[model samples]
Target: MATTKTVDLILDAGMALVAGAGPDGASVRAIADRAGVSAPAVQHHFRAKESLLHGIYARAVDCHLEVTAAALLPVVLPHAERVAEPARQGVIVEMATSVMQEWLREEGRATLTSVILHLLVHAVRDASYGDLASRWLAGTVTAFESVGVAGTGDAQFLVELLIGAALVSAPGRFRCENDILNRELFRSACGARDWDGGFWLERYRTRHERTRPDSDPSGEGEGLYARLLDVCVALTAEVGADALSYRKIAARAKVAPSSVLYHFPNRTGLLMALYREVHRRFMLAAGTEEVEPRAQAAPAAGLFAKLIVDEMAGEAPLFLTSCELFLASWREMELAPDALFMRLERGKMHGVPQLSPSERQRAHLHSIWSLGLALTQYSHASSHRSRDVELRLRDGMRFLDD
Candidate 1:
């Protein structure tokens, strides 16, 4: 019989492999090898690959939720006592940030989150998983309420936001440039003393300009092209790519169907154009044109993360729109290529201070510290407490370092 320690060893190895290569990558044979066990030995312990995966998934969810609870416990206590003054609020924010950074640094958490996301996508399609999922969600909300944050709706929103952030920042996975927006939101929530919206807006505009395809600079093709792009994006967000028709876009854009065809010519052309437009906007929103791009980019990333949490916590329409976009992109990979480009650009644009390979890794580690800190905005479960969402945004720009 496998010792308890041996079983844990196998599970740990399996999780590591899954973290690096995803669930598909963690083959039973590979896991067995990693665990220094024969294939049959591995099977003896896990019975089946699905069972092993379920174990890992359950652990990951529990671990993350535990970390989340630990982080929020102090904040909730003070808020419950009605002693959440500005200084106390600041401490709570800092504490939340620190806990988030810690969570992000934990590779297990990231891997588990990825696995959970995989499960969630499949669960949404499978009715059999409904009861299990509902139970999980309910338990999660109850946990938050127990810690002082109140309301099931608020808890659900925050959970979705955290899940969305995990989805967006899944290591080695693809995500939209909207991550910048998420980061900006985090900074805003953290009580930064010098948040600057104009700075982010300008950076967004510059990024947009860089990615836009060369067009008739004379402005002849600009209007029709712009309208077509807008309509396609709107429709894509509305009914998804398969349901998007030129006729629908024309109706939404209030342009004639003939005008839409005049610019796009075909569905492929329209899809491509729409895809390009989303990337263009994402780059514009996420790129750095500021003199100190990394410095600027870091805060923006933080702020954007916070905003996502706040909006999702409120169950706002914009959050729903963003979620739809995220889900649609999964089905239409073409619409979501921006995630890859954004990751590359972030690495390149932020590649300054001339660090060695190890140093670069360390810097990335530090950036991820902020990344996790930014994610805490999504873990709270109080809609009334979230009234400070805009306040957090205002405070974010206040702390921009030179």
Candidate 2:
């Protein structure tokens, strides 16, 4: 007789496994074993592995909302009518910002976020799982509305940006850019007017770093090396990083398994190579110079937004694969440092002309928001995909004209 307690225990065990090792770790039998229940019990509760995965995410999301209750109360609780709109909005924005900051800084919440993202990455390919992901995002917007923030484009992007930051950027780095990031976040979250771009421009100029990936050694034949990378990228985009095996790559490339290993000795090396290759493809596809640290001249403000649209239209597999890798970096500590650099490097500021400081900042900001948007929307129907990308591009371009 499995009670509600039995269901909770099963969900707890599933989340722990998935969070630590991704979707592959949370097998039905394994979850049941961890929960000290028979495999039949897990089946009885969730009915299938897919349902169990969905259940894990639903539980995690509910727990997140539960914990967030205390922080949101400053805005959630009713206020006096005498309070000015600006003052009340300020409290709401402040509370939202604090809650997001905790998502970055707090260990328990961060782990839960990782679990959510892990399942989300799965949802990109799994239609059944995508329903839960969609509901979770919509519920977030509704949650924001309850706290007085309107469901404007900026507010939507702010939610995406916070989710993206949790996916890729480290907590310390999020704190480092807190002031600049929050200025932008507050504008979007609370509908505040835009401010000076000088602080962001100066920070962009001084703080951005460039480190090139290791060049492929020619001893193993550069052609073979490049071929291996192409296969890895395609497979990763089709399947996922977790499902990638050396045998799989070799089979696709029609090369010996040892040859694949000879060129790339480990999973980390292969992933790093894949990152550089993906970066090169993005630069070339955007009509920017691939080898340079910055573009020849700054691209137009909405250029990256257009670039995102194009990628979704044509190169969706690659785009989603990049999203998977970025999120994976957050969960895998050894990969975090280089992956962080790779992510920040994608939003270089030096090459564009007459670019306003705000535009430059928005360029970087939109890049993050795009990651979140693509993750959540890519699994939808084709018509919705086009509409969402267009809306995202429109919302992203709004700051450029200022």
Candidate 3:
């Protein structure tokens, strides 16, 4: 609307730029120019660039959650009297499909939805996102609770599944890969079962049916732990963390479920171990550099920049799935792997004599923010302009200042 306020215009412009050119495109000048306003106007509305990015992130989250749910409601409500609650879940496939198709029809919404998803999976690693994420998720939890949908043992989990499925499957990005995600999420919402194993796991299992599950013979299970972790990580890359199961893990490891459980006991044990393995590898990659001493001497930013390039280039899937697990844990109110790992790592980083308390905190936030931006950039189909990425990197460097 022409009458839209300055902040809203800036948010819209920022979202548009991100959608078109990835995280690198959301520069202050670009957003300001798109909004037909001076750079000062952008700063006037949102003082810091970080705050502006958060504005875009928050707006995108709100828009997707509200719009998608609203779209679903209208269709479901029309037949409210005729269909029973149990029956509603089964019959609403067509309704859900229509809602999804409608979501795909609008490029603006689709882009915004993807951007919000990017934020949810990455920006959330920052402590600054805690209040915002909690507040938004609280509302989401309430909405799902009120629905009283059958077969939803955990309303919060279903809420997350719905959001993830809708955004990941949003039209045009990766259609063929996401179709199963969309269908399974729809069925699960209404009252389907085994959503975790429904389509994603089944597909993976079916394709790899030739690889049958077996137990280690002759009491020779020396490298079982490492093999299991590797298989779990690979499976996580293919299907999401939420879709993982002990059976799936065992199936891929080519071991009896009991053999896999011998090391991990339970699914949580397996996942936590898998998480730690991923973290260990990431730390080694980020910390180990054969380059000049200058790169290593600089604070977190330099190492993070190099790590971003490395992760995006060859480690894309691992980085992608790792972030997905981090994000899912954050949503479910479980202790995040980063939360635990950072505690140990933070103590090491704090050994620097010059760092202040406030500076330390900012650095922590900056580290998380950088990872989120890197993840967002990796998820995109292409890179934004060089100037755009440089602007983001330059502004981020300011956080290193005490």
Candidate 4:
């Protein structure tokens, strides 16, 4: 029989492997070997591969939640009590930042990294977990709202940033010229205008509404390219970017599959084009006009953050596809520089600024942090709390001040 200590040893070994090679590498025999136990002994303790994975997943979630709750509890309690002192609010943020930073240091990283990666790599299997995370975050936000001390970022948004920061910053994940991408995304974001924040809604009748075949006997007309892109966007939302296929896009577009190839050439090309369109729309909706190349950063960043989160909540599937592509870029060597370049071009088209290296780095961090916010809010279907969402964005825009 495996002792409690021995079980700990087995679970630890399994986590180490998962972190290094992801979920695919954590085979039972491999776990057994790593744990220095016989295969049957490993099975005796965990009867199935899935059972073993669940063990690790639960363990990681518990550890993550415990640390999170500890840090958030103080702030939440005061908020729920309606403590509304400005001084207290400042103190609470400082204390919360300190506690959260502690987790980013040393052994805390090791403890959290495996779990975060596990969550990301096997995100599909654990759809329900995201809901739990959403509820946990909302509670934290509500706690703060109840208190008079208003926080710029809600608990859920803050933790979302933590998970994202932990994942990419973890040594195991690939790092790229994110600062460059950040500048472009920020610059492009600044180029547009007109912000309406909502979730899953239809726009008021546009001047050029397309006519469906039943209505006009023509077809969904005047927006074939736009319609096709919308289909791609919707497809990404439904099946995720990983499963996005040309055949699927064609079927949804009601175009020939070969026609998709005619326009896109390949999967990468299709995705790149689709994201460009999506990003363009994002910029237009997020911005009104460009400022003096971030002569001021916070105001501009705030606008973009608010816009991004609004869209994320309403159009999560699109953002999830974007997330999928973002991860894909990290894994595909040939995709590099192109992914960053395309983003830069988009920004230039919308007119992004020429940022200093340091400034660009700050902007990149801002983009990453924002993505984390979106990932948390939209990736799961949970109750929407608009106040908390705004708090998350305001807090994240702080990175722009650097």
Candidate 5:
């Protein structure tokens, strides 16, 4: 039998290894070595690699919930009896901003979040993992609720918003200006009035002005490049970028292995190119100008419904590949900014010029909300039909306003 201390060592080793090098570097043998145990000893504790990964993720979530609750309980407890409902709402807003600020200021927090995101990517693709992810999310929301976020919907939105904030503000890579937007978003999540802070929105320039895959700067290798990227996208959506390789792409695309290398040169470049392509596709999907929130809730709800249905129907690979790569890119130092940019300035917000100022602001929020919705849907491992997904999306879009 494995001692509790030995199991803790194994779990800690797995978390640190995954945080540093993602799932690819966190093999059972590697974990055992890091834990100063034999491989068989680690296996005796975890049973299998999947079980070990689950243990690591579950442990991380437990620590996160404990820490967050500790930070929030003192602040919220005093107000629990003293405040009226509206005053308590104010307290929730204050705590929401405090949570974001504390999250941003904490040292080594991003490392832990990066590990969670990696597991979250796995959850997006694997149904069993998705069930674990869903439970983690529910547990997290419950933690927030215990600390004063009263409504289930409000608590859920804040949790999702924080996840986006963590991803966009990767360790030491996020822009300082964008921090304002996040704080404002935290307030908005708690039903606080919108802050007049659109300056940060203007600072984030979209990397590619054109959101078309065919609009590559170098026109050379158009046919083969597109074919290779298509294969990479499919593969990355299915298994994630860590498992991707030139030979695998070649085999899938029916191109020579050398050809993929010629176009991409390295895995980092290949992943970035796929990120760009995926970003472009997402832009097109979200570029529905006909659906304006200010017009009424129906059009906006319909747009989100379409997007979610497309994701569930496998018509849009963006929901799968985009978030997966976005999380995975946190471990890739050179790719961090590009990933942050994709999260910070989702391609849709830049192209839509018809929105009013507040609408534009809400558009940015809606984009993040949509990403969260996709994450939530997949985390629950829903096998809903398009109509079911559409119905759920319609209900979810009520969160678009503050």
Candidate 6:
């Protein structure tokens, strides 16, 4: 028992170090010192530093899976009712948002996500680790049924989206920009007042119309919408979600603010177009080739990861727009059911290749796990440092045929 306790202690210390310093910071000697154990003793259980790190990751993944499951428990009934009554979608959304916020508030939740994300990146190269991750993902999706969001695809997307956000923000070590955006996102999710789509649109259109376009020789209006989106993507990648605005986007696109408004009309129009464009680009990058059953599943999973990485790495505008959309959807769930449903459906469908009939029964559970894990990874990549994210994402695509 004492030996077991010591091993656990060592793992805890290692996770703490990784959480604080990122992957580069957690060393075996440092872990030993932090755990109050001798270096050799640490080596005894872990065998090597890599093994120790993996162990920490495994434990952290398990802990996050548990917390996520607990978070879903309170909303199961409402989720079920939402299936029959479309009007109840808002209730379901609120339930999900509340559960996630509660989970974030729990102690050590942030570090746990960071460690899990780091491990997931490594898991791509290690089949045993991958299987462990797969199992956890499966379990998380199953837990979501208690709330009523049924399809595996939807479950998967939700898990990935949430996990991606967490990975971007990583709980405790939140950046100022992320904090502001996340707080707004949380409010939007909870039916709070600040997330009003009308208000945002009004603000964007009013500001955009105030500026004049330059008399460039080229008929710049031809591709103004596309150019603006590109600029938004660039801005979003550099900063967190808070940096998106007409002035910022116009400055980056080298267009007059009025030009932007002329094409987009209002913030709502701009945001809707941007969101649709992102979806289109994401699907294009994801490709449309039908895969053989043996390989069918890989493309969706890889696509999901790529869609997230591209958005997170490129700029803040797209993500900022995403947060606003999330809020907008929450405020007016009925106004955009298709969009919400599509997002949910995409997540659930991404994991279809890996499950069988029996496993399919557990699809929602797996979806949540994958989503949670994905979110953790995205959050870390956005907010923390982990060399393995790109490699791991690459590995996730290996099953695809180019």
TM, every model: 0.48, 0.80, 0.46, 0.52, 0.86, 0.49
Clashes of 1: 30
Largest lDDT belongs to which candidate? 5
Q: Is 3 or 4 the stronger prediction by lDDT?
A: 3
Q: Which is the leading candidate under TM-score?
A: 5
**Model 4 misses residue 147 by how many Å?**
25
In model 6, the runs with Cα more than 4 Å from the true position are 77-83, 124-128, 172-195, 198-402
Model 6 RMSD vs true structure: 14.5
Error of 2 at 332 (Å): 1.9
TM-score of 1: 0.48
- For 1-402, candidate 5 gives per-residue lDDT tens digits of 459999999999998899877777799989999999999999998888999999998887777666667667766767655455456657776776666565555365556667777767677667678766877788878877776545677677667767766666655556454466676655544445445544455445433233344443367878888877778777777777765778888898888898878888877667678877776665567575654456466666666667655642123345677666766666676776666556655524444566654566566666666666667666655566455545545555565443
Model 3 scores a C-alpha lDDT of 0.52
TM-score of 3: 0.46
The C-alpha RMSD in Å for every predicted model, in order, reads 12.8, 4.7, 20.0, 11.7, 3.4, 14.5
Which regions of candidate 2 fall more than 4 Å away from where they truly are? 68-70, 75-93, 105-107, 170-210, 214-220, 289-306, 309-316, 349-360, 382-384, 399-402
| Residue 255 Cα positional deviation in candidate 2, in Å, after optimal superposition | 1.4
What is the number of backbone collisions in each predicted candidate, taken in the order shown? 30, 3, 0, 11, 0, 39
> Which residue segments of model 5 deviate by more than 4 Å?
81-90, 101-108, 175-178, 188-194, 206-214, 266-269, 291-295, 312-317, 347-351, 383-392
Q: Rate the local accuracy (lDDT) of all candidates.
A: 0.48, 0.65, 0.52, 0.51, 0.67, 0.51
- Model 4 — TM-score against the truth? 0.52
Query: Candidates 3 and 5: which is better by TM-score?
Result: 5
lDDT of 1: 0.48
Among all windows of 10 consecutive residues in model 4, the one with the lowest summed lDDT is 195-204
Question: How would you encode candidate 2's per-residue C-alpha lDDT over 351-375 as one tens digit per residue?
Answer: 4467665545555655566677767
